[model samples]
Target chain A: MAIRYPNGKKYTPPNSEVKKRSIKDYSYSNRGKTLEDEIDEANDFYLQRQIAVIHKKPVPIQIVKVEYPSRSAAVIREAYFRTPSTTDYNGIYEGYHIDFDAKETESKTSFPLKNVHPHQVEHMTVVAKQRGICFLLIRFSSMERYFVVPLEMLQNAWTRMLTGGRKSISLVEFEEQAIEVKPTYSPRIDYLQAVRKMLP
Target chain B: MAIRYPNGKKYTPPNSEVKKRSIKDYSYSNRGKTLEDEIDEANDFYLQRQIAVIHKKPVPIQIVKVEYPSRSAAVIREAYFRTPSTTDYNGIYEGYHIDFDAKETESKTSFPLKNVHPHQVEHMTVVAKQRGICFLLIRFSSMERYFVVPLEMLQNAWTRMLTGGRKSISLVEFEEQAIEVKPTYSPRIDYLQAVRKMLP
Candidate 1:
């Protein structure tokens, strides 16, 4: 029987040929990976070196039906993805509570405010109030530029939007207010160096 | 088709009659709820009051198959429960990074060492080294007693067990090393008070 997702999309297992092709494509080109993948690689590197212990929170799901196919394996037969209440990444680094979300955009001129959810903004505000280091890692994929924008600046932009201002943050504002994070070979994205500079 | 859990137990949705009976039973008896439930309620109270931001990390699951049944929801058809790499609860309180797990035992004389997992112990150790507050909220349900045992004390007990010592921590040791946490109405488990006493 064919399986169905909550979004009414049919689930088709990737064929071996497609899998092989994708693997070859990814191995040959940096364009194959998303910004989130690069950040995850960086997190793994940081963890192995004991430099930091950050982790992306797992996607939350609400399970309605589960089937125990064996004594040790439970297969979820019905479940829905739930909206996450907080940002993607959070952990400790140098005794600081670190929390952030990585975002990618193809546009080079401005980042759309719609990319960020209001609840996430509220969560960041709360974390910051608790003295945690909260920020966003935004990737301008078209320009190949990455910036670490602190929660305060994001909040300012959000407020401006609420007051009938531009609905996006311009590249000019990003250059002035955000810290640039250069890409690296080993860790992939060394955004922490930018974070270290932001720390008081 | 009937659903089942990883343990091979059949999953039955609680009908309204069963639910009503359970609610009445719980309303009249203190035996109905688990320690974890009380702690969750307490965390909710704390969050509602803006006193703390602690949250129990959702159980991690490895999704193998998902099907779209509708445009708005994706139903997972096959998934397995994954072992979590860290403790259950973590968040910020009073500018401090707090990480802990709540454990309940029916033992009257001693808490069994088997209840704590090796990976969880290692995680607590790492968090402590990072200067984050890490501990175990252990409840002797039989005695209706809860204690906040610091990672240091837990490490000591684990080490003793490794050296062929008793496989459980005696109540006497708890009196000397652990801080007692009293239950309250709103924040069902006021563990932070115990945490405050542990802080320098």
Candidate 2:
């Protein structure tokens, strides 16, 4: 299967079957399912068993222009992101409040710091202060690896940013602290299992 | 002060002193804001004070076509509501999860039953079973009155449908059970005050 970016450029998934599969073979050839689609599928699976209740928060958009062509339909002609939102997903899991962001990086060596928005990091920090489970699902597309990095590691990365360090998180550092998640068809990416393992 | 809907439709506020006052009127004016604008303002107000953190869930839309003008922007050309969504707003307040739907009815005598969808009612029933606070914010636009009617009342109304009852909720019943919310500028709907009153 061919991988394509929004730019219409054809790309190759890391550890493709055409090449020798690595220990971190987590890339998907499916073209129809987006990152959000996979996450929602996983959420539905969790909900069915009464395991967790989670949802992706809507992107807050300010509709500048709307065309009501008819009485029943209102079409937004122009809109903009209203504010820097809190995170991608949040809800209750096993009697604990869970908050997280899902991010994809094509870098093979490290995930760029620029991928982590300042406002989102601040929001995750607040979630941590409230004792909520906060983390990020980091997808290394080039390495075909996925890691669940806790909010503490993210905060530490942010602190390093203030000191003018490298603009990316090295894969070596990630392997030491981040928990790896194996992908499956039903739940898509069962990162929660990694989360469960991390939990005391 | 002038009263208006978010889309700039003019109206007289419930108790407006000015014949054409903008800021002089109480809250619930749309002279300068839109429906989405009011919901955003209300959510921010709730979050700031650690009050009831309510938010409008995203409208479930099935996008059939997208017109990508640039790499950073994509315009949805065709979309439709996928399924009947549960409610407009939901969040946590003080320890209880609060869920509700807001609707405006122009009929002074009765609110049309057509406005409430079967799926939303079903979602509310599930929420109720989970011990969540579920209700509806019914606004009699012409009468300038708003009420928070519990799901139980709505379920009773649903049952009455089979017996061939009126297809609308009478104003008398709303006046008896629905808590009237005097809108404010900052918090807009100010539904939490009503929530506090509802709790035992």
Candidate 3:
């Protein structure tokens, strides 16, 4: 099946071979899927099972030229994708206000600060002060390791970087401060169990 | 200044005269602004004052074409706006998980049930079950009345309608069950204060 965009343009899937290979090999099920894709699948699992209702905020777009082909159908001829002003995923989990972004890094030794935007950092800071559950789901893709770093820890690192500190959080520091989330067949990345440990 | 899409196509703003007129009249501040826009501005006010961190999820778009006119600037030539799979606004407020949709109707006596989609109702139901705060910010535009109708109230009406009841919720029913929220200067629709009233 040919994947096409709304405007009838063809959309090429990123990694078709790897996606096919991963489905066949259960051991490497998590290999082909991107961190965001895995998290989305996990959220779907959670929603279907009535466990949680987290969702990734849609990418903001500025629509300019919209053609009404029919009375009910509006076709967008032009639009601009805008940067998100907040974190990606957020929802309720057992009465808790959960807010976080799922990020992936190729670096094995450190998670680069550049991967996160300043606005996101500021947003998370405010959310934390409001007593909401704010954290980062950082996945070191090369090493197949995932960590749930709390807002406070991220703030400390962010503050340090702004004041002439390291641009990245070292793996050593992540091991001590962040909670590791192991992958599962159903939820994919079962970070909520790790989140439970973070609650006061 | 003329508005243009990323594809360099001319863009027309909705309700241009009302928008232009509203900019001049300070007293009729919320005149031209849609309920969603008013809520967005209110959310901004809340965020800036450190009162809450609510946000409307961006409308999802399927991008089909892009034109790179320059090395750094990528222009979206074609896209399609998609119907949201979830509610519009959601966030944390004083340790509460807030989720809702802002809707406007010109009808004076009753608010039509067709304004609320099935997926949104389902989403709200799930969020309510998870113990998160869920409701609807309904505006009777002609009557200049606004109400925060809880998910339970909405559910009751929805169930009745599904079982061949009235297609609309009467003003009497709204007065009995829903919490009236008047428009204000800072947070245009002060629904959070009303939400606080609903909490135990």
Candidate 4:
């Protein structure tokens, strides 16, 4: 099932005819790598140089069955997702506790609210109140751009969704507050420079 | 399949004949809930009052099929587990970086080394090298005892394991190095007190 796009349109599975196209056919595409793998490699690159300590939060899962075919490998045959209660990445960088979730959206004009969960916003509020450095690393795939928007902006947008406003953060508002991050091969999404400028 | 108990014995599923016992029959037992759920709840409790901000590092999973029944629910139909690169819990506790793993054993006299992955010990050492507070919250069920053992002790045991020594930490060693933690309802495992006495 496709999720509702930021523009309130249903997203359908791309046809196999379109899927056969090469990486050049898609915008902001880093070949065929999944989001988690790319971000993980990026974080490893950052950590190797003692630049920062950032890690992806594990997706919660409930396992029901495991078949042991061999002594070395036990294959999980059944599992279900558990609702997450917080944002993804969090750690200390240069003595500042950094918290954020990295997200990529195909929408052109805005990023949808549904892309973010309510608990994640709540998590941001708690982190902000504790004086932790918090933000969301948002990527506009169609535009091939990434931005780090402070927690306050996300809090406001999250509140708006609660009060019957549009379920997305407008591109106009994001441009006003977010610090742009240029994509790189080594770190993939180099966000520390933006964090430095924001927190310094 | 059941893992081996620390006492060099395999766990046979509790007799199927005893399945009808009431909740009080096993009130003191580590049943009715899984270790992961307990850790997750404990982390939530710790985060709410600003006592600590620990979270389980997510295990990487390879997703193969996702079925969307409706607009809201997406069910993961097929996936496989992958190794996690970091420790289970890592966050700032009282201004000091705290990282650890909570492991339970059915043994009465020792905790098995096989329960811990080698990479996890490596991760803990890295955290300790950075001067972060690191420890293991180990629970022995047959004895109904919980202990917080320092990472140094764990590293020593892990090194011994590589040399074909005992693949467990004996009760005598745990009694000396591990701080006893009395389980509670709110935090379940109140480990900060141990932190205060040790790291502080």
Ranking the candidates on DockQ from highest down gives 3, 1, 4, 2
- lDDT by residue (A1-200, candidate 3, tens digit) is 23323333234346554455544565655656667677888889889999999998887777777876776656677666577889988998988899999777778899999889999999988988888899999988767789999999999999999999999999999999999988767777888988998887
Rank order (by TM-score, best first): 3, 1, 4, 2
Clashes of 3: 0
lDDT of 4 by residue, A1-200 (tens): 23532222234355433466566654434554535556677678767876666777766666665556666655555666677777878766665667888787878899887878778887777666656678988877656678898888888888888899988888998889788888765667678878988784
TM-score of model 2 (first chain only) = 0.81
Task: Report the CAPRI category for model 1.
Answer: acceptable
DockQ for each model: 0.43, 0.21, 0.50, 0.24
Q: Candidate 4 at residue A192, lDDT?
A: 86
How many pairs of residues collide in each model? 13, 4, 0, 1
lDDT of 3 by residue, B1-200 (tens): 23433333234345453545544455655555666667877788889999999998877777777776676655677666677899989998888889998877778899999989999999999998888899999988655689999999999999999999999999999999999987766667777878988885
True contacts kept of each: 0.54, 0.04, 0.79, 0.20
Tens-digit lDDT track for model 2 on B1-200?
Answer: 23432233345454443335566453455444333455567778877766645556654444445466777766555544344345666666665567778777768798887878887897677666556677888766544566778888888887787589878778887777677777666777676777777664
TM-score of 4: 0.75
What is the alpha-carbon interface RMSD for each candidate?
Answer: 3.0, 4.7, 3.6, 5.8
How well is each residue in B1-200 modelled by candidate 4, as lDDT tens digits?
Answer: 24732221345466442355567755544454445566677778878787677777655666566556666655555666677777777776655677788788878888988889888887766666656677888877655578888988998998898899998999999988879887766666667777777774
Give TM-scores for every candidate, taking all chains together and pairing residue i with residue i.
0.85, 0.71, 0.87, 0.75
Question: Model 1, chain B: what is the TM-score?
Answer: 0.84
The lDDT of model 1 is 0.78
**Stretches of candidate 3 exceeding 4 Å from the true structure:** A1-28, B1-29
Candidate number achieving the greatest DockQ relative to the actual structure: 3
